[model samples]
Target: MAQDTARQAPPTAPATPARALLPLILPALVVGVGASLLLLLVNGVAERLQDLLWTNLPDALGVGRYSVLWMLVMLTATGVLVGLVVWKVPGHAGPDPATLSLHAVPLPPVVLPGLLLATVLMLAGGPSLGPENPIIVVNVGLALWLGHRLVPGLPGGVWGMLAESATIGALFGTPVAAALVISEALAGRPLKGALWDNVFAPLVAAAAGALTTALVAHPALDLGLPPLGRPDWGDLLAALVIAPVAGLVGLCAVYAFPYVHGGFRRLGHPMLALPAGGLVLGLLAALGGHLTLFKGLAEAAELARNPQGNSAGRLAVLAVVKVAALLVAASSGFRGGRIFPSVFIGVALGLCAHACVPAVDPALGVAAGVLGLLLAITRQAWVSLFTAAVIVASPTVLAVLCIASLPTWLLVTGRPQMQLREDGSPVR
Candidate 1:
């Protein structure tokens, strides 16, 4: 007992670099591989289930894929199903998802099954959220539990950092995205040494996770937008105007999210609140059509592929309905992340801008639009910039986006976040 206590006692100074390196590397690799495999399983099952729900059953029923009646019925049923899990399942699926951020304290191991089940239902049933939060929580919990047993001396928050980094890396299909996100998150905090010293292990884990997903599952974050040839003054002007417009659109939803969340929580039971949210989401889906379904990645691709096919008015409706769907799913008893849907919302806004003007460069408009929405929703500059730029897949507009994001940041900086306060109060 004395030896164990002494091992945990505060050191006179930080460990030497040589000693720190191996300790960081080995655990990161283990956690990274574990996280990667878990995410793969979650995504795989969800995809198969989605195919069954939206494809096989509908075909068997002779119903059209986007039929309003079918979607309405299926979504509400999903709500009942997931609500049962949330209410009756052990661990109650951890905590209210609306109160969670991209990262949070590790949940207990017992929470894993119910959380994953609820998440799969949300995804397969066509909620506007993504697998990010649920999957991250799973990874964090597993990593913490494993790390404690295997590497008792690792610093606090190290496993969480690794889990978050690995998840981001897997989701976006790149270690660099995780690095940028972590850098933005860690920017203002007190530091003990060079940033890279702390970041190195997580980066290693992120790379492993990113590479594993790419090699095994075929990474899917790309938007496949047309390339921008060169920068022009017209593009610059459009970015300055359009990015903030997207930010404004996102801010509107951000403001509404907490209120909606609080209202649902007042019901005081997942069984009641989730079905109600599902019904409203179904109604919104009926209004917005099938394009509003899912996490928005595939639909965003569809939108980008044929911008000319959708009228400007249609694009605007898509953005609004998606924002509404996102809020409803998140505030209800659904378990998921906000980033993927936010990307879809940003794409809709950008496409709307381009459709309305028919003058702004398409690629530039899409990139700027994403930049603004990500900035407003995440309040993380590096993440917003990287996400926007990567989707556009061009270097020409990065400078303009950087400049455009500055003003948008001001608009979102002090504003209320989308997550609810723990006391069940609205953010505002």
Candidate 2:
């Protein structure tokens, strides 16, 4: 009789009831807004410090703000400062950044302060990395720590997902990017429900985060390039050639990543490795000029604003130097993301393509270049496509970008990724 009763009961529902997800909306909203605020605060503080170091202090000292001497001093000093935090601060700033990813495990709350401090220092000190990875880690850590305490019934994974989606949305100032990224992440995972059911909460969080950031920061990703009216065969041909070439360029960095990271690890300590890395970056900076120094957003914008300002050779130099700088900073002890720097490299390469072959539309070159580099570096297909398309702010470029991505994706797939494993090997 007991067996009959047990068998008669229906199996647990395979999908979550739509109403079951409704309760998550409020928490998602809160997490989303908080994530954006955190990003804003970090960036604001970094920008202020950057101004102090590069502008006010330089003016007072009567030195050119971007002089080779100043660049060397600042970068090396940044390494020392960050190294001190990593060496002395508790938890050693979480983990070796080489082993971390944009979707890293939530770090202990104890590690958050030191990690953030090191990240801010890297940003202000002019490393060729972006705030995305560290910032996402910090947000995820905070959300899980706080949310678990406040709502003990909910799983930590829920909080982590909300935070990650929220942060990505804030980073790009669009929930669409977060959705695409999260969807890609969800592709192969086991699921108890429809994909939309699983994504509902995250989408809400992402929307809130994106809205908060857009309202506060007014950030813009569009490059304001002249429109590519229609992609002719010539344009298609340019995208195909330019994207793969750019992917090859980015793959150069990916192949070298482990070796570079291994070199720094051999230095035996953050104190030595970071400073040495800084010196190398300083040299790259001097070679590439001030435009190549920071995380590449503003600099990429500067490049796009006046593509005619630089010759093809000069643009090529900028692209190569930025890639080298990114590799060095990431492989060393610096705490930041590779995405922004990759964007800059892509833009420079695209502009160089346009300059070399005036018949190729600048927009197509830039978009294709970004698509290839992003595919090679981040290995996130949705993000690569989204970012490349957003750069030009044109739907017309999508058809070409879609086709261009095929060859680029094929080239990048199965290659050693830019990320490193715990054993200091590349993730293949």
Candidate 3:
């Protein structure tokens, strides 16, 4: 019998040792922490920029007087600037903002620096987009890139998972938003081991990020809205009335948002574009009153604080006008996160909903109403729930708000979206 060379036993390959894995994981975590730290430093800067834009734009632009053509001119001007930035640096430009969460796709490490610049420019310049997504994406991408470059032998997926969790955790200043976003984004993907991997790194990163975010900028997330005294029979009735009214308003905002966006995109010519949107926004602000312009967060918070000051007519008017303004400001050409304005619109609408029905607790009704709209349009129930809780300033309301958010979300998901996509893409 001849010995067959083909049948020779295969040589055993070396198994990956714990020591080898340590280098890859360690560096990636370090990069992630650095990114998180950077993000934490910038969060308040972004917030302050957003505040100035929302607070000052209307008065500065001489809103409420511009004609339609003038508004178009204003919009065109903004379009030009936005177009220039997007053209020069497309990577940092975030996903269509009117949709759900502030989600950004991972890109090359080179893009992170540019993205950071773009975020500051857009938010500071008064484009109606948010900063959190860019903050998260840049961190995540940079961490993974550094990991790969440093340890070429490591599994890319491991670095990716860590980067993702840490960046998001840092960006939001809380693990809750990061966790909720992860869960929603992975809706259909195979679970596998993501449950552990996607979550743990962020918790670690967030711990550091939150401490830094607070120490550096002192972000106050909890506003402490009062809790609702247990739902009475009146509260149940209030809920019914709210379902239809809020649903209609939410539907319209979702439906109308694109047309607002399209007008600017259509101009195509950037110079002639921004001024047009500006003029339109100016006039609308004038027509709807000052609250009609800018991001609307302050206005919403004010209305929630003093709902009785505005008559039923004013709140009702605000509910319609603010939504239109946001759609226009956001859609026409300005860039910034939809998160603040969306919450504002929801809170304002909630206040209006309370006015519609006399029996409901104004605060509770306000909380429920705002929660409903955010849940529908953003489609992130967890964020919506927290946001509503933050607004009311009460733990007790959080429980009821949580319950109310679900039915509202279900109602919204059932509808056809006219503009914002479930996955964060916009129609345009």
Candidate 2: tens digits of C-alpha lDDT, residues 1-428: 99999999966537889789999999999999999999999999999999999999999999999999999999999989999998999978878888877786788999999999998899999999999999999999999999988998888899999999999999999999999988999988887787888899999999999999999999999988987897899999999999999999999999999999999999999999999999999999999999999999999999999978899999999999999999999988899999999999999999999999999898999999999999999899999999999989989999899999999999999998988889998888
Q: What is the lDDT of residue 259 in candidate 2?
A: 92
Which of the predicted structures, 2 or 3, would earn the higher TM-score when compared with the native? 2
User: What are the runs in model 2 whose C-alpha is more than 4 Å off?
Assistant: 1-15
Please give the TM-score that candidate 3 achieves against the real structure. 0.75
Better of 1 and 2 by lDDT: 2
Q: 305-406 in candidate 1: lDDT tens per residue? A: 987778899999999999999989998879988888989988988888889999887888888999998888777688889889988788888999989988
CA deviation > 4 Å runs, candidate 3: 1-80, 87-101, 109-115, 125-128, 150-172, 194-198, 292-294, 418-428
Worst 10 residues of 3 by lDDT: 64-73
Write model 3 residue lDDT over 1-428, tens digit each, in one string.
Answer: 23675468644435445454444445544755676677655654656764544445544776533344433444344455565655566552544434423555567866666557656655544333455556656766776677778777766765655556666555455666666766767677755443545455445554555555556656554433455777766665565556445656777877766666665667765344545655565555555665544455555666766666677777777767666666665665444555666666666666666666656677677667767766655666677776666667666666566556556666777565544554434543
When summed lDDT is taken over every stretch of 10 residues in candidate 2, the lowest stretch is 10-19
Give me the candidate number with maximum lDDT.
2
TM-score of each: 0.94, 0.96, 0.75
lDDT of each: 0.87, 0.93, 0.59
Better of 1 and 3 by lDDT: 1
Off by over 4 Å in 1: 1-16, 426-428
Q: How many angstroms is residue 204 displaced in model 3 relative to the true structure, after the best TM-score fit? A: 2.3
